[model samples]
Every structure is written in C-alpha cells, then in structure tokens.
Target: MRVASEMGGVGGTTVMLAQETGLARLVEALEGTAREIDVTFARAGSQLGEGLGLFEGLKERLTTLSTDLSGPEIARAGTTLSGLAGELRAINDGLLQETGVLQQLAAHSKDASQVLERLLEHMRLITILARSARIEAVSVQAAGRDFGDFTSEIVALTTQAQRTIQNCARDHDHLSALLGSALEAQRDFEGRYGQALSALAAKLEQTLVEVTGRQQRSVALTSDAATHSGKIAMAAGGAIIALQSGDSIRQQLEHAIKALRLLAAVTAGTGEGAALDAEARTAAGIVLRRLEAAQLEESARSLAQDADSIEAALALLAGDTAGLLDLVRSLYQGDGGRSGSFLADLEADLAEASDLLAKCDRARAGVDRVTSAMSTVLDTCQQTVAALAGTVSSIVLIGMNAGLRAARIGTGGRSLVVIAQELKFAADQVAADAAQLTPTFAQMQETSVGLKSGGRLDAAHFAALDQAMSESLAALRQTGDRLAATLDQLTREGGGFASVVAQARLSFSNAGAMSDLIASGAAELERSVAEAAMPDDPAAAAAAAQLIERQVWPNYTMVGERTIHQAIVGALLPAQAGAAAPVVVAAPAQDEADDFLF
Candidate 1:
C-alpha cells in the first residue's frame, strides 16, 4: 500500500508538471511572437534609413562625376586647340621669311651672288627642314601623349570588360547549376505533389462526408431556428403592442394634466365665475384622479414620456416667473407688503415645481429625442430607397428596350439574352426595394404625427417663456437708462461743489497773509509819526492833519478795507422779502486792534 501511494503521488506530480509545462510554453510562444513583431518593425526602420542615406550619397557622387569628367574634358580640349593654333602661326612666319631670302639670292650673278644664291638655297632648305622637323617633333609629342591617354583608357575599359566577362561566366555557370537544381527540385516536387494530391483527395472525401453530415444537422437546426424565430417574433409583436398601448395612456394622462393646469390658472385669475369655475374644477379633479390612478397601474415604460412633459412644463413656468412678478407689481401698485407676500409664495411654489421638473426632464427628453431622431432617420431611409427604386426602374426599362430591339435586329440576339436577364434582375431589385420601403414609410408617417403633436406642445410652452423674456429685457433697458441719468447728475453736482470749496479755501488763505502784512506796516508808520515833532499848537496841528483836499491811495489796500465796506453795505441795504441775507464781517475791538502792533 505504501508503494502504491508513492506511485500515485508521483503520477499526480508528473501530470501537474506536464500541465505547467504546456502553459509555460504557451506564454513563451506569445512572448516570442511579440518580440518578433518588434524586431520586424525595428529592422524595417533601419532598412528605410539606410535606403534614404544611400540614395542621397549616390545622387551626390553622380552629380560630382558628371561635372568633373564630361564638362571639364570638353573645356580642356578647347584650350589645347588654342595653343596648337598659335604654334602653327609661328611656323608659317618662319617659312615665309625663308622663301623671301631664297628669292633674293637667286636674283644676283657674281661669284659672291652665286655663293649667296647657294647659301640662300641652303638657308631656305634648312629653314624648311627645321620647320618640318619642329612640326614633326610637336606632332610626335602630341601623338605620344594621345597614345598614352588612349592606352590608359583602353586599359581601364579592358579591365571593366574582363570583370564583366568573369561576372557573366559566373552568372552563366550559376544559371546552369540552378537549372539542374530546379530540374531536380521539380522532380522532387512532382513526387511530393502526387503525395499531396493523394492526401488532398482523401481529405476531400472525408470533408465531403463531414459536409453531408453538417448539411443534415443544418437542415434540422434551420427548422428548429425557424420555429424559435416565429415564437420570438410573436413575443416581440406582443411587446410592441403593449408598449404602444402604455404610451397612448401616458399621452392621455399628460394631456389631461396640461388641461387641468391651464384651467386652474384661468379660474384663479377670475373674480366671479363661480358656476363655470366649479364645473372646471370638478372636471379637472375627475381627470386628475383618473390620471393618478392610471399612473400607479401603468408600466414603467410610460413614465419616461410623463417625466419629459413634466420637465418642459416646469421650465416654461420657471421662465414665466418674471412676468408673474410684473403682473403682481402692477396689481399692487408697488406696495411692498402685497408684492412681497405674492412673490414669496409664488417663488416657493415655482422652486418646488422646478425641482420636480428637473428630476423628470432629463429622462423624458432623452427618450423623446431618441424616438424623434429614429423616426426622422427612418423617413430619410424610405426616401432614399424610393429614389434608388426609381433609378433602377429607369435603368431596367432602358436595358429591356435595348435588348428587345437588339433581339429583333439580328445576329447579336445571343448577347442580348444577357442584357435581358440583367434587366429582369434590376426590375426585381426595384420591386423588392419598393416593397421594403412601403411599410417603413407608413411606420415613419405614423411616428411623425406623434412627434409633431408633442413638438407643438413643447413649442407652446416655450413661447410663453419667450414673451416673458422679452418683457424682462425691456424693463432692464429702462432701468439701465434711469441709473445712467442719476449717475450723470451726481457727477456734475459733485464737480461744482468741489470747485466752490477750493475757491473759498484759497480766498481765506490770501486774506490771512494780507492781514499780517498790513498790521506790520501800520505799526512801523505809527512809530515814525509818534517820533516826529508836532508843529506848535495842538488844535492847528489836528486841523492840518484832518483837512485833506485830495488823497492818493496806494495800489495795495488794507486787509480790513473790503471787510469793512462789505459790512457797511450789508447794514445799509434794505432786505428783500424773498431774497437771502448777505454776510457781514465785524471790525476788531480796541484791545484786539492794539494787540496787532507787536
């Protein structure tokens, strides 16, 4: 038993190791694949960089070679030709001088002339020989240089040709070897192909058996699927009917609520419409009770639509608050108590409504917009299908007509058969498109009617808000104008008061300085007068001092002169009943006047 237990444990461990090994190998393979992908990308990047660098280098080398070899060679040859022409001209001049000397020697007859003639002939011959030798030497030198250049070029060409021949021979040998290898490979491949074909035939036989079995299974599956699909379609139809019914009920409830709310508002506005008001309230209560009952019993699907309607109504009511406030103000004639009471209650109610609407609005709008967009899209699809059908029908009719004419005309009737078949196919396609579009359009039309009705309700609600906003904007404009006028008046009055204060302060400061100057001058004059001797009798002196026919006043006046004159005028002037009193300044008393002397 112990041996068997150990064996079993070993077996279990071996199995676990095998499983772990398999998992490890799977992970390694995945890692290897990822590494290979990264390596491939890196290699591609390197190759692309290398290719670009090589292209740029090659371009630069080719441009340099073209300039250095072809263009410079032509320019050098032209310079060489110019030098050769100058040498030829010098040779021609030497020949012409030699010819003239030979003519002069031939014209003499004495022994000296005969000797001169022989000498001139020798000179002419020497000159001709020298010129010929010079020309021949230059030609030989040029030929040697040309031969050397040609030899160098020939050697270079020969070297290139040898390399090309070697390469061609190597390539030819390689091609022969490759051809032999290919023949051997082809023989091997033919043998493998026979084996492969035999295996493929066997696999085909097996596959056909499997396919036949699969087809049988598919047939059974298809039948079962058809049955299940029929059941599912029935369920879907029932669900759609239930959904639509729920939607209808929800719509009715929303309509009833809207009517009741409107009636409530109207009744509240009226002072005495008791019987009609009672009837309206009774009808509203009945409708409200029915709606509330329906809401409790209805499916969750209708709640979305109800939520949407509630939200829109709340938004409209909130937007109309400013209008309501204005109407209340008009009724109360700006009485704070009445306005405050009405506004507080109204705002509280509106706030509650707004909160409730916020809750339902998001859900409602989402569903409605989705439904609306779907209907719009479906309608557009129908239109597109109809247009496509029209085009296809026209094409089919034209093709059919053309085919029929070709069939009547002659030998091309065989080709026209294909055209006829295509035309028939096109007609079938158009008919199928129309069939599909008809039901889609009908459904879209029905959905569109629902959308239009809902849209009208939403528009009406928003229209009230639009009107209220317009009124608010107008009131704001008037308030802005009034505030602007008040600001302007305040600014102008502030400026004027500031100017008056500044002038008063300046005048007061000037007066203080003038008073100080005058007091000092008067004290000095008093000392000088007292120090002067009085002339004889007191009465005569006093009479002489007092009697003045004309007195010249200085440009500067005493500080108290204006003050004194103002005081005297104020005292003598009669007071007008409605006019304001004038200000007066009192003169300083005796002690106060004496104190200024210091």
Candidate 2:
C-alpha cells in the first residue's frame, strides 16, 4: 500500500501521450524486427535448400558413367584391335614364305643359265667337228657332196641349239632379275616392314586394351563417388533438420512481437478504477524490456548455433558434390575438348592398324605377283632345255652315221672317221651339259609352281570389324561426352560452395544483431516508463522481471516455447503470481497449431 501511494498518480491523457509516442513506436519497431528475422531465416533456409539441390541424380549418373566405360561397346573396339594384329601377323608370315620360295627359284635360274652356256660351248665344238668331217669327205670327193647335206643338217642343228640356248639364257636372266628384285624387297620387308607391321599390330591391340582399361578404371571411381553420395545424402538429411530451425525462430520472434504489443495494452488500461498504477505499470514495462532482451539473446544464440550446423553440413555436402564431379570428369580423362574421347582414340588406333595391315597385304600381294611371273619364265626355260637336249641327240646320231660311212670308205675315209669320232665326243659333251641343265631347269619350274600355288594371306574381316567396332565406339563416345559436359556444367554452376555457405552463415550470424535492435528499442520505451513512475525500486524490478503477462500467453502457439518459459524463465502473470499451480494456457488457433511443429 505504501508502494502504491509512492507510485504517484498519472492522468490517463498524459499516459496515452507517452504510450503513443514512445511505447507504441517501440512496439511497432519490435514487430518490424521480428518480421526481418522471419524473412532472414526464411532466406537462409531457402539458400540451404539450394545447396542441397546441386547433388540431385548425381549418384545415378556416376553409376551410368562407370557402366558405360566398361561396357561391351568398348570391348568390341578391343576385339577389332586384336583381329587386325592377327591379320598383319599372318601377312608377314605369308610374305616371308613366298619370298623365300622365289629366292630359291632365282638361284635355280642362275644355275640353269650357267649350264645352258656350257651346253652352247659344247654345241659350238660339235659344229666345228661336223664341219671338219664334211670338208675332209669333200676333199676326198668320195660322195662328199652327199656329205654336204649332213654338214648342213649338223650346222642347222648347231645354229638352232645356239639360238635356243641363248633365248633360254635371256629368259632366265629376265626371270632371275625379277626374282632378285622380289627377294630384295622381301629382305626389306622382313628386316624393316615385318617388325614394323608386327609391332603396329601388337601395339594397336595393346594400346587399345590399355586405353580401354584406363577408362574402365572409372568403375573404381564409382566406389569413391558412392561414398561421397552417401555422405551428401546424409548431410542433406541433417541439413533439413537444421533448416527447420528457421521456423522455430520465426515463431519465437512472433511471440516476442506479441509480448511487446501487449505491453502497449498495459499502458492503455481497459476501463476502470485502475488495475496497475503507474509504478506497477512502469515496473511491468521494465520486466518486459528485460524479457525481450533475454528473448533477443536467446534468438541470436539459436540462430548462430543453427547457422553453424547448417554451414558445416553445407561444407560436407559441397565437398562430396565436388568429389562426385571429379569422379565423373575422370571418366572422360580430361579429353573433353582435345577431340580425344575414347571413341576417337579407338578410331585412331584402328585407322593406323588398317594402314599398316594394308601395307603388309600389298607386300604379300606383290610377292604373289612376282611368283606368278617367275612361273611363266620357268616354263619357257624348261622347254628350251628340252629342245636343246633333242638337238644334241640329233647331232650325236648324225656324227655316228658319218663315222660308219667313213669306215666303209677305207683309207680316204680314215680322216673323216677321226673327225666323226671327235664330233661324236663333242656331241656327247653337249648332251651331257644339256642333261645336267634339265634337272636344274625342272627344279626351277617346280619352285615357281609352288610359290604361285601357296596359300595367300587374308584380312577378310576388315570391313565387318570396322563397322561393328566403330558403332560400339560411337556409343561409348556419346556417354563419355555427356559425362564431360555434366562435369563442365557442375564446374560452372555449383563448383564453389564455399562462398555460398559463407554468405548464408554470415546472414544467420547477423540474427543476433536483429535481436539487439529489438532490445534497443525496448530500452528507449523504458525511458518513458521511468518518467511516468516514481524512482525504481529493486523489489519492483525483480517482480517486473518475473512477470509473464496473460496477454502474451495466448500467442504461445508452440508447446516448447510455453514449457520453456514456465520452467526456465521463472515467469508468471502478476495476477497468478501467488497461484498454487501453473496457470492454464489456451490452445493455439487451428492455423497456428497446424504450423506449431518445428
């Protein structure tokens, strides 16, 4: 009662003016601060949502990229490389065989030519002996005129033999030179081209396997991506919970605004002999100011704590997201714009293999042509050797007949007999030479035949393989290119989460500052309260701090907010200060209750 009397009376008009200009404005300002906090938290939550959006479908894409890298498309390319290698190897071996046979045929040609030349010398000697016999028989004139025909026949035979042998030698020379050229080419092919073709074939296949194998390693990358995807998914879940803190803070701020507005109501008393005098009212105002200060402090702390959590979650999410991008990029192997995709590399290897294999094919085909030409020349040589043998036989017969005729002529025929004997010996020598040449010439013909008839090297799968492999590689290229594009898009769009997280963190950290504004406005209104009331007492200040006006209790839509206020705030309405139990609170509006969940 003494405190009430000390709480000097204030007129309603004066109270209204003070409340209108100061308390009312403070209430309006607190409402503004509360809205700002709502907006700020809303935006922060939205930003967190955006951060989570960057990794959607990322795991599936990574798995697809891994599968494409090791798919059957790539395997087909490898097979093509292997097939080309085999074809080139076969050509190398075939050419070697054909070349060796041709080389042998050339040697045989050289030997036959030598034999034919020796036979020519013998034929010349026989012609000399036959002519000598003819001249001696004519000098004796014992039917020597008849001997002229024999000499003529022998001369004709010698001439024919000389012509035939010379023709054979010429043909042999031509064939030998041709075979020599082929042999030289074969040497070059074996020494240089053979190893090169083999290497190209092997390297084409080996490099293809290696290249594809390297790409297949992307499957290993999926392991890391899968882990990162799990973390991102989990972190996103945590972030969802952290983001919901905004709604809770928004509700708290709304409650704080309602408290300030109710303080305005206390200043404008509802009718009557007066409930709270200026002292009581002034004390209550101070209590509200302090409570708002506590609320502001609490709101700031909540914001900072939630912000820290969200930012941490964002940190992990961003890192894992970036890691997934890295894994996807590895599938392309930095071959994005270099025109060096898996398909490109495979095609290049195939082209090189085709080129080298084609060269080997041409070389083998050339040997085939050389062997064919050698066969023709060898056939001619064999015929010439046979003709020469026949001519030598005829000359031997003519020489024997001359010898017999000379024996019948007695003394005059003795010189003719000696000539005939020498002629027969020379003819025999020619026959011997021709006989030796026949086997050599026949061997050459056989070699030429063998070379022409040998199996040819083949690469019949080139056309089919090229089409099949190219199709497979084309598919792989599309997948790889898509992955490269995804990685590039990620780099441009979501690559830097650090800055985004920082901005969000900074915004949320300013939540404490917004609360400070509300507390500052409250202090300004308290100055008005101090002016209207008597000097502040410590007891009144404690009572005011402990007051929880019933006006604001209805707005405690959240159960946690009400529970926390009753337990930790140690606050109660002035009317209920001496109650036995806690005051009963009204249930929130349906709309408010609908959104009461944090």
Candidate 3:
C-alpha cells in the first residue's frame, strides 16, 4: 500500500513537471513570436508612415509647381506672347503702310523738282525778254535827243531786273539742293527701315512659334502632374489603411502573448492535468479571440489595396515623368537652341533698328538746320526782292518825272511815257515771283517737320516692343527650366516611396505569418499537454518513486544538502488510513550522511 501510494504521488508530480516544462517552452515560443510581431509592427508602421509622408510631400510639391507656379506662369506667358504677337503683326502692317507712303513721297518729290526746273527756265526766259526790250529802247534813243534820259532809265531798270533774276535763280538752286538732300534721306530711311522691320517680323514669328510649342508642352506636363498628385493622395490613404491593419495585428499578438503567460503560470502549478488542459483550452480561446480580432486576412486585403494603390500612383507618376521627360527632351533636342537663336536675332534686329533710329535723329537734326538755313536764305531773298522792288519803284518814279517833263515839252514825252509803263510792269512781275516763293518755303518746312516727328515716333515704338518681347521670352524660359527640375525631383521621390511601401507590405505579411505560427504552436502545445498520460495506480506511483530515488533524487539532492526532493518526499509519505503506526523507511547507507527527515 505504501509503495503504491508513493508511486501514485511520484506519478502525479512527474506529470505536473512535464506539464510545467511544456508550458514553459510554449510560453517561450509565444514570447519570441510576440516580440517578433512587435518588431515587425514597428518597422511596418514606420515604413508605411515614411512612404505616406514622402507621397504627401511629393503631392504638395507637385501642387505648388503645377498649380501655383508652372501652370499659371505658362498660361500668363502664352497670353503675353499672344498679345505681343498681335502687336508685332500690327507694327509690321504699319511698317508696310509707312514704306508705301515713303515711296509715294519720293515720287512726289521728284515731280516737284521737275516742276521747279521748268519754273527756273521760265524765269530765265522772262529775264531775257526784259533785256531785249531794254536794248530796243536804247537803240531807238539815238533817233531823238530828248529820249536820252529815258534811254538811261531803261538801262538802269534792265540792270536791276538782271540782278532780280540772278537772286531768283540763286533761291531756286538752294531749294533744289534742299529737295535733293531730302530725297536721298528718304530713300535711305525707307531701305533701312524696311529691312529692319522685315528682320524683326521674322524673328517675332520664330519666337511665337517656340512659345506656342512650349505652351503646349506645359499644358501636357501640368495636366500629368496634377493627375499624379491625385494618385499620390490616394496611395497615401491606402498606405495608412495598411498601417491600421498592422496595428490590429500587433494588438492580437500582444493578447496572445498575455494569454500564453497566463497558461504557463497555470500549468506550472501542481494542478491536475485535466485542469491544466482546461486552462490551456482557455488560453487557446483567448488566442482564438486574439486571432479573430487580429483580422490578418483583412490586413492582407488592406496590404493588397495598398499595393494596388501604390502601383496606380506609380503608374500615374511614371506617366507624368514621361511627359516631363519628353518636354525636357524637346527642350534639349533643339528648342533651346532655336530659342537662343531667335533671341540673338531679335537682339541684332533691335540693335540695328536702334542704330537706324539714332541716324534718323541725326538726320532730323540736320533737316532742322537745313530748314532753318533755308528759311534764312528765303528771308534774305525776300529782303533782296524788297530792295529790288524799291529800286524799281524809284526807277518808275524817275521815268514818270521824265515823262511829265517830256509831256510838258509836248509830243517829245511819248518815248518817256512808254519807258515808265515798262518799268511798272517789270516791278509787278518781280513782286509776283516773290509772293510764289512764300508758299514753297512753307511746304518745305512742313515736310521737314513731318519726317522728323514721324520717324522718331516709329523708332520709339519699335524699341519698346522689342524690349518687352525679349524680357517675356527670358521669363518663359526660366519657368520651363524650373518646372523640369521639379518634375525630375518628384519622379525620384515617387520611386523611393513606392519602394518603401513595397517593403512595408512584405514586412506586414511576414509579421502576420509569424502570428499564425505562434497561435498554432500554442494550440499544439495545449493538445500535447491534454493528451499526456498520468499515472493513477499507487503501484505505478511506487515504481516511479523508486526510479526517481535511484536517478532523479540523487542528482537533484547534489544541488544542495536540503533540496526540493526532501520537501516532496515529506509531503508524499504521510501515514496510510487505519494504520497503527507511521511507516518509516530505512535510509540507504550512501544517503545516511545526508540528513533527510521524510
């Protein structure tokens, strides 16, 4: 009976030790897996957050570049260029009209010069007729002695008429010289002005072409950037969803770890195997609840969504980058070179036009001086004509006096009366010629003023337009370059974000798998503990005790003089029921030196 009781006690203790060892190992596995899950959760959350952050940053940058900077700048540039092109076209049209006007003016000037030539010839003919009349008067004088003073008066009037003719000829020559100089200036201005306008027009057309091309590219690139920005926003949202799943998984792992620790504590006690099994089942229930709550499958679904969203975003960004790259390629291919050439040509045209304008200013100054000199010469001619008029009037009066004297002397005064009448006609003719010169002088002054004012105004307009166009083109180019650089940076960052999201997804998957493994291990350990055999018979307990005493007790006692073996033996060796005396077992000689009171 005693032996059977000892065997039963040893068997129960052995079963309890086995359960404790299994529970400990199971707890170790659960803790290790939980730790791994925690690490994975942290890493996945960090990665997901980083990816989302990068995507958001990229979105913001794209928004600023596409919406705030590049888009508006491109549109403004397009509008400005369109306006400039219209202005250039209008200016070119005006230039064409001005060229036609200049041609007409040149033609009219030639005609006016020809008319002046005829007027000069007529004046010479009139002077010759006056001289012939004077010679006839002198020849007839010899026929009558009383005609001597009349003949002398005729000679004086003829000499004065010759001087008047010479002065008119000099005035005509001066007017002709001024007309020749104006005609040459007009021809030179027309040629140079036309060439400058034509060159400017061609350059403006080229610049417009390049601007239009870049505007199209900007539209496409900005559209692509906007699309990519939307995609990035979606991707970031998806990544956040995936990270939420990782959070759920982490929570489940923590519960599992807690349940496993509870199970280990219960199994390590001296409870019955059935109680241990019950506690393990309870732990398993907790694990199941944790798993159900973990929603690993949901996490996987979220990860899939994240991946799809990221991929879509990547595709959008890739397309955006491709468009930007095409624009960059276009810029690098030949657009920049063409633009530079256009700028260079425009500058050259502007410089030439500016030089022409300077020349025109100089010409205007020269024209002013010429007009002033001509006005002075005209004033001098008028003075000379006035003096000649006074002299002719004096001659006429003298002829009149002679005629009175001759009339007083009877029919002898007839010759004197004819000379006085001739003198009066000659004076009237000279006064009429001087009156004609006033209108010609006024026309010359008006022409010089028109040319100076008109040329200067056109030159100023050309300079202003050219400067505005150059500044606008330069600003557009700068905007394009900055946009290209921004696109390149966004592309690089988008790629990095994609990579981070992918890695995070993989880590989440691994963590989920580890959690499942830990749950499986806990369940298996519980099952093993529940199925483990327990010795119920006292005889079997006695045999197990004997084996433990021979093997386990000796080794266990070596750890200390008084050990847990003594406590267990003392507890297990209580007296049997209806026994008269307590059962005392003899100590072995080898254990005699060891004080064991059981």
Candidate 4:
C-alpha cells in the first residue's frame, strides 16, 4: 500500500523521475518560446510601423506634387510647344516668300548689269572718238583749234560719264551683294528651321502624348499604392493583435507549468522519508488527470490555433510588405534609368525649339538689314545714271555744234565733222543705255520692296512661355526627386518589415512545436498518473483532492483554468460541493465551441 501510495504505480518511481525531467524540459521550452514570441512580435510591429511611415512620406510627396505647379498642369503648359511650332511654320513661310523676292531681284539685277555694260561701252566709244577727233585735227592743221575745242569738251563729257558709270557699277555690285546675303540668310534659316520645325513639331507632340499617358499611369499607380498601404496597415494591425493574443497562450502555458510544479510538490512530499500519504497520491493522480483532460488539451489546442493565426497574420504581413516594396519600385522606375525624367526631357526639347525660333528671328533680322541697305543703294544708283544721261546729252549737243562748225570751215575740216558725227552716234548710244538702266533700277527697287518680311511672331509671348515652362519643369524635377527618395525609403523599410514578419511567423511555428512537445509529454504523465495505484480510502482521497484544489487555486490566473478546476474539483470531491462551491462567481460561457480562451 505504501509503495502504491509513494509513486502510485508499479515501478512508478522510475516512471515519475523520467516524466519530471521531461516536464522540466517542456517547461524550459515553453518559457523560451513564449519569451521569443514577445521579442519577435515587437520587432515585427516596429518594422511594420517604419514601413507605414515610409508610405506616408510617399503620400505627402504625391500631394505636394499635385498641389504644386509640377503636376499635370506642367504637361498642359508643355503642350503649347505645338502652338509655338505653328508660329515657327508661319515665320518660315514668310522667309520663303522673301527668298522668292530676293531670287526675283537677282534676275532683275542681271538685266541691269547688262544695261550698265552697254553704257560703259558707249562711254569708251565717246572717249575713243575724242581721241580720233584730236587725231583728225592734227591731220588737218588748219582745223586743229576747232577740233581741239570740240575734243576737249568731248573729253570732259567722257570723264563725267566714266565717273557716273563707275559709281553706278559700284552701287549695283553692293546691291547684288545684299541680295546674295539676304538669299543666303533665308536659305540658312529655311534649311535649319525646316528640319527643326518638323522634328520639334513631332517631338513636342509625342512628348505631350507621353506626358499625358504618364499622368494617367501615375494616377493609377498612386491609387494602387494607397490601397496597398492601407492593406499593409490593416495587416500590421492584425499581426499586432495576433501577437497580443499570443500572450494569453503564454498564460495558458504558465498554468500548465504551474500544474506540473504542483504535481512535483505532491509527489516530492514535505521532506525526506515524508512521502505524500495514500490519499494525497490519489489527489495528485486526480489533479493530473483533470489537468491533462481540461487545461493541457485546451492549452495545446489554443496554442495550435493561436500559432496558426499568428503565422497567417504575419504571413499576410510579409506578402503585403513585399507588395509595397514592388509598388515603390514601380513608382520610381523613372529613376531606374529605363524611362528617364519626363518634365526635364520636355524642358530640354522646349529649349531646343526656342533656340531654333530665336535663330529664325536672327536670320530674319539679318535679311531685313540687307533689304534696307539694298534699297538705299538702288536709289543712289538711279540718281547717278540719270545724271550720266544728262551729261551724255550735253556732249551730243556739243558734238553737233562741232560738226556744223567744221562743215562751215571747208574740206580740210570735213574729217573733224565726220569725227563729230561719230561722237554724236556714241552719245546717242550712251543716252539709250542710260534710259534702259533707269527702268532696270526701278524694277530692282520694286523687287527689293518685296524682300520685306510678311510678318513676325510676337517674341515676347514665346519668351514668357519659355520662362513659365522652365519654372514648371524645375518644380516638376524637384517633385520627381522627392518621389524617388520616398520610394527608396519605402523599399528599405519594407524589406526590413518582410524579414521581421518572416521571423515572427517562424517563431510562432517554433512556439507551436514546443507546445506540441509539452502537450505530448503532459499526456504521457497524465496516463502515468491515471495508471498509478490509488489508496482504498475514498473519503481521505476526496478530502485531500479538495485541499489540493484550494491550495493550487491561486495558480489559476485564467478564468478557463479556474472553471476547469471548479468542474474537476466538484466531480472529484462531490460531497464538498458546498465547501469548494464555485470558485468563479459567474459561470462564464465555455469556449469549447472551443477555439480561443478569453
């Protein structure tokens, strides 16, 4: 009876020792797992919070970008490049018209050059006739004085003609040069602007399209990120709640440990050779059976269930954390060097187009200067030619007088009269050439008027547009930088969060494993206790069970533990129901539909 009372089974002494060691190990594992749960969850919560902060930074930056001029309005402003291109096309057309005028003027210049050549030839003939008349005077010595007077007047007229022709030639050459310069300037403007107009027009149009598309994509991406952030926040909340619930599992494990310790105390008794009495052993057996049946099984099941919840919650956290990371990466793909900055690129293209337009203006100004100077030169040449024609007429009158005077003089002076006739013919030719030159000059002057530009674009309008667009692009670039920074922060924080959540999930699994080992070991000990021999004295056992329940009641912190103890104590010591009564003032609802213990 004493041997049965000692360990409560045949050779139960050895079995009890083994189970005591197993219980110690189980308790150690449970303690470690519970402690690890706290640490892992703390880290998980902290990391998740940091990720949330990073996402908030993104939201704030996005809001600022939308509020500032850097947003879609900048794209709208950039679209004005197409209008500028239109203006450029118009300006280019004006240059083309003026170029046609210069070309026409070039044809008129050719005609005037021919007329000037004829006039120069007639002046040379007049000069030659004056020399010939002088030679005739030398041949006819009697008429030498008369011929000398005529030749001298002829010489003066020829000298004046030479001067007038030289001046007209110089003026024509200068006008021709002006025409060339204007044409050349127009060609340059046309070549550069034609290509630029096409390219800038196309590029600006394409850029506007791309910007609009990006704006739409940005809106969608921003919405997605916001939704993902909310999900992450929700997942983090669930994980934190699940982590908090793990504490209750720890409490349950603590109850199991306390029960095991009480079992040890009952078996160990108060001192050496002071083993527990027979009824006390029975009480210990009953306590083990009830603990395994109610508390250990429930604790084990709760552990499994709570651990799964923790794993699932943390797993969701990990998934969403990774999703957030990807979202951030997608947001900043512009920084990734694949797509490049949008507004900055548009700004560069705008600058190029602006520069082309400015060059076109500069070329137009150069043409204007050429045309003005050419008109002045054409007017001066016409006046000189008119004066030359009058001088040729005076020479013709003098030549006629010389011829008549020589004819009156006699046969010896007849040769001088012939020379005078030749001189008159040359003078008439000069008058004809001068008359042709007049119409040519007038025609050239009319064409020079056509060289004036049709009109010009308002330079100030474009200047202001460029300035506004530049400011908008700069602001947009700044916003893009801030967005990139936010994405980078999100990536870093989210990566850390993923790692922490994974670890937390792993820790929950580890705790579950420990709880399983504890439950299995507890089951073995409960069976050992149940199989242990009991004392024949039922009354002492009942009284001892009641005393044990009252003693260990303080160890039951959870209401479930108290309720389990209450039911078991009432059954084990039924007669003392009034004494044990209900430890719980209110019979709280049982959780055996039995997932989580409150």
Candidate closest to the true structure, highest TM-score:
2
Q: How many angstroms is residue 286 displaced in model 1 relative to the true structure, after the best TM-score fit?
A: 92
Model 3 lDDT per residue over 15-75, tens place = 6577557656755765675566557657766876776677666756555554424256555
Local distance difference test scores for all models: 0.33, 0.64, 0.49, 0.67
Q: Which residue segments of model 2 deviate by more than 4 Å?
A: 1-73, 95-99, 129-134, 140-145, 189-192, 211-232, 260-290, 333-339, 408-411, 435-455, 458-547, 571-581, 586-597
lDDT of 1 at 105: 22
Q: lDDT, candidate 2, residue 164?
A: 84
231, model 4: CA deviation in Å?
Answer: 2.7
lDDT for residue 101 in candidate 4, whole number 0-100: 79
TM-score of each model, in listed order: 0.19, 0.73, 0.45, 0.70
The residue-level lDDT of candidate 3 at 134 comes to 49
**Total clashes in model 2, counting residue pairs 3 or more apart in sequence or in different chains:** 0
For 9-68, candidate 1 gives per-residue lDDT tens digits of 677456435533532343343233324323432343343333334323323332332232
Q: Candidate 2 at 583: error in angstroms?
A: 2.3
Residue 141 alpha-carbon offset, candidate 2, angstroms:
4.8
Candidate 4 residue-wise lDDT, 1-598, digit = tens: 3334335566667766765676567667656765765575566566556655655664564454333323655555555655665665666566677778778888888888888888888788888888888788766665355456667778887898888898888888877787778788878878867677767777777876666656666667657667776776777677667667656767776766666666655655643113556566656556555664567777677767766776776677677656655554444454344544455566677778768767876776666677668867887888888899789889989989988888887887788888888988888888887888888888877776666434434345446656755666676666667655655555565555566566656555566676676577657666665655445566656556555655566555566776777677666566655555554223335423333444
**Residue 235 CA displacement from its true place in model 3, Å:** 1.4
lDDT of 1: 0.33
Score candidate 3 by lDDT.
0.49
